[model samples]
Target: MRGDRVTNEGTVPSDSRRFCLYFAHIELAQKVQAGREAKRTLHEAGVAIKKQIIANTKSNKSERHKHLDELEQDLKILENELKEKEELKRQAEIPENAAKERHQKLWKVEKRAMQDLISRNNQMREMFADLDTNGDSLISIDELQKHRELDTNPENEFTVEEVRSILGSDSIDLNKFNTTVFDQLSNSYGKLLEPTRPTPEPTPLAEPSIDSITTQPSSLEIPTDEEDLRTHTRSSYKNEDDSEDDYEEYNHRGSSSIATSLEHEKHIHDSIAPEYDDETKRLIQIADEARNRYHEVGEKLLSIKRQIDDSKKQSSVDTGLHDEYAAIIDQCFDYEEREYTYRICMFKTANQIPKGGGSEVTIGYWDSWCGPKDNKYLKMKYSNGATCWNGPPRSLIVTLQCGTEQKLTDVREPSRCEYAMIFETPLACDETIATTSAHLDHVEF
Candidate 1:
């Protein structure tokens, strides 16, 4: 104690620290037990006073009646005092119990965090082992950069120098500073990490009752565009008389009933043909010319359409590409699954046609091609077509692979109101790319 500035010099040693903590814990436990005992004493004292009062209530009244009131007052006072002590005990324990519960919850959280760290640590160890394949306990820069997937950002992929900087050397020791290695690996290659998804159990495919969309025999030929068809029809009927104008109007209304057209023709010949007096002969001649021209032009237009089809097909073959050539449109692919034949029309829609002669139902309409442009195979989506009984609007994903002919390989409804079809089509072929790539490879050293 120099100059009255007295200071304690003894410091606790490391080996005795545990004992000191244990002693403090014991003291806390003793204090808690003492508080509990005090509350119990107060409760017992109140119970004894209650029993004494009850015993005095039935005793000889002449001797103790004067003290009976005093005894009753004392009992009430004791009860009140006991209640106050109990309340005090509860108030004292509340913060302690709350703190205990909070500590328990925090411990659980920390435990889980530690477990996750252990898991991540083990994963890192395995990755390092794989990267250090040479058994030198060090991963070289070349080996590290070989996995370009390690670059989390594709736009700013790691250069060799960046990788070396991250490694802190030309090579990284697998056993040294594991946490640092884990962090660096995570920062660079975490996106390449594959996460597992929980797969659902397979469910049986459902079959729906068929509904009719059409009655005519299904034709495989591509339908002409409306603009082209309109042009052809206008040119073909330009020379027809006014009498034929009504028929053209009927046709333009999209009537497919041959019976109706025939009936109208009969009406013209029977009713209208007899109205003209002396001009009947000339009108008859004119009607005959118009009829002849109509049939001739119809035949010529059909022949010309067929020729155009043949030329487009030939051009597709010459170019050695099908779907990309613009000439292979409106093609149909039929896939039979269970009891239904799914007919998917390219650039149009898909139909669920029953095999046992039921109505054809529209399942989906062509939305667009669904993947990257340069991909050899095609993924097309048909959407907003049919309505399911208890589900959303039906949709189909049609996957097309190159083949010699058009046909379906597989059909499945993998989810409710959603269909998947794998089909083969000559239109999917890209022979030009395939052949040139192969030839170039042969010419290389």
Candidate 2:
């Protein structure tokens, strides 16, 4: 069977040649079948792999288009939001700019108004300064009536309390003269004018019945100056011999009718009222002043008598009354008048400091108790200070008075570089009647 051949010997029909036995070649047959099976498995696997690739590529393309569309929508939404915000800002700027302009205009108007007020106040200061003649910072209703610019009619007349309220002081307040007083005076009179005044006439005297003995005139805002009483008096026309004899007799009598020190001074305001401007008033004033002067001179004579008695006695430099007010020593007290701040240090120094920031000036230095002859402790003098511009050396006289509290008030420049003020304190309360009486109707420097 291994060598069997289909040749001409068999000569079988081509269709009958299948009977040739080849069973011995089974191994070759098996190898051929295995190759066919491997080819079939390889072709089937390739087809399946190609189909899967096409399907996956299509799905990926669709997903990419969806993602790109979503990204575009988000970008559009963000752009629209940005446009809305910009439009809102543009709308808001219209009112914001307008508000700024309005505020600027209002500020300008207010600034102009404030400047006008200051200018008006400055213009009024010169007019009011003339009202204070004695450097006492006071003005009487009778004095105010002299100016037609002031409405001094009875309906608008100023009482003492009314003046104190409107002026905010007992005197013509310089601080308020340019503010509240300016407004009030301007409202009362349409325009403010500087009063063209004549030389002042001497004030007349009056009787005591019109007002209380202890009280000053109801029309007066403050007490009339004692110096004014003596200096501004009208003399009673009489023979020179009679006047001299009267003075001599008063000196001999020695103020025996002087009831009390305060009462003696009060008689000028209480006893000699301005309504009693007759010969009787003149006689009363003359007698009162003579008694006061007699009291003063008698005390002086007695003081000299004591000094003569102690002529051989050793003179003492003991502090005495000076030490009583030693607590005020080295302590600074300030009194404001006009543009300067007056500073006084008891038994030390005095100064005038400018309010608008300038070099401080030395007013004076403590010198001595320069009061009247009888009571040497009533006034303190400071001298030999910084000189005026080509003038005398500056000096300050502090007049001491008895009061419940310690204070400095009424600073005045009576003469060139010569200053004066009143210092009230409790230390002077216990002085002798003789000392107090000497200063009753007068205080001499």
Candidate 3:
């Protein structure tokens, strides 16, 4: 029975109990399945999330690398640009430096040329002054001939052949052959004439006087009858009172003789006074006139001497401008960052530059009044020039010439902050044109 009952309970189970057991079993199985499924799902989800995270990290790293590379390229490009700019700056400075050097060279050349012109002009002026005769402004053939004749020595008179040899073929003009032919021929040869010796002064004469050779005459004699007078006197004296009267008469006669001699000497002196007075007045007048003439002659000689001294002083003082060229440069132009000007006078004090601005350039003449005749070169003062940054004020130099007009020809900058200028003027023209022509002819001979 127990066996049968256990079999029945197991086979047919109690409805409620069976159901409860079955339900509990099913629920437990479901819960366990659900837990298992949930665990699997969670593990799958974690794996997926890890995969996504790794992919995202790789993408982000790649982008960062790309950006870094781009930044590096940009840095390289900026460095190359900076290098190019540095090279361009170096190239730009070269031309400016070269220009400054070129201008300095030009200034030196222009200065030398101006000096040469001045020297040539001075030489011509001297020749003209030497040839000008008779203190006249013009030089004619006749006047030149007189000079030639005066220059020739009596002992060495020029022969026709000698004259021809000295003058050459061009000495005469066939169309103008008159009495002037001889004169022209002589003039052509006059330059070759030598200086003559001067004449000596004459000696003075001795004077003679009439008073040194005259002799004086003797005094006249007078006689008296002393014996007769003595005999008569003795007879009268025989009477007692007669002897005393005779003695008194002899004393009276002696006194009368002395009085007559004194009266004669007084009359002679009174007669000569008028003639002596006239002679003295005449001698005084003549002496005064002679003294006045001597004073006039002395004054003339002194004036001549003074003139000669002045001429000598002028000649000595007038030296060539070349010697003082450096000093002249200092006087003319001042150095500045912008430019420089230079000026020089051949034989006078020169101003180098001027003060101020603009295109107008002014030139001056040599200080002629302060210098000698030989030093009379034209001087110029320039003004309104370039300005400097932090240096001296604008200035200029004085240039000398022998031309017809005073004008600036050109201005330029040849160096860094340096300048050069060219000028022309009438003051630079040759004043002795005729004399220069004559000199050239002489040189050809």
lDDT of 3 by residue, 1-445 (tens): 2222356446544556666677677676677667655545444444344344445545654664565556455545645654555455445445433333322322222233223322322332333334444435333444433444433453675455444443343243321221123333334443533223221112121111111111122121112233543343344344444434533443333311111111123223243211212323444455445555545555554554555554343345432342122212222322232343434333332233543554433233333323236654433333343445664334334344332333455554454333344444322333233122211111110
TM-score, predicted candidate 2 vs. hidden true structure = 0.26
Model 2 C-alpha lDDT per residue in residues 1-445, reported as the tens digit of each score: 3344568686433422333223324445556656655444443443344334445545654664565556455545655554555455455555444333333332232233323333343445444555655544455444444545454555665555555555566555554454346556664653445434332222322222212222311222211444432332222113333434433433343311111112233333243312332333544455555555545545554554454333212122222343355345456888887799999987778999999998999989988888789777778889999999999999999997655556787799899999998986655543232122221122211
State each model's C-alpha RMSD to the native.
56.8, 54.2, 52.4
**Positional deviation of residue 424's Cα in model 3 after best superposition, in angstroms:** 8.4
lDDT of each: 0.52, 0.51, 0.37
Quote the positional error of residue 154 for candidate 2 in Å. Answer: 99
Instruction: Summing lDDT over every window of 10 consecutive residues in candidate 3, give the lowest-scoring window.
Output: 205-214
lDDT of 1 by residue, 1-445 (tens): 2223323865434545555666777676667666655544444443344334334433533333444445455555655555555555555455444433333332332233333433444455556656665767678888787767666565787688866766777887744424345556754653324323322112221111011211223221211444543353344334324224534443344312112101123223233322222223344455455555555555554554555554444334322222142333466767767788888876678999988897887889867667467762467788997899988989998886655555789888899889998866545544343332111111111
Ranking by lDDT: 1, 2, 3
Q: What is the Cα-based lDDT of residue 183 in candidate 2?
A: 52
RMSD (CA, Å), candidate 1 to true, equals 56.8
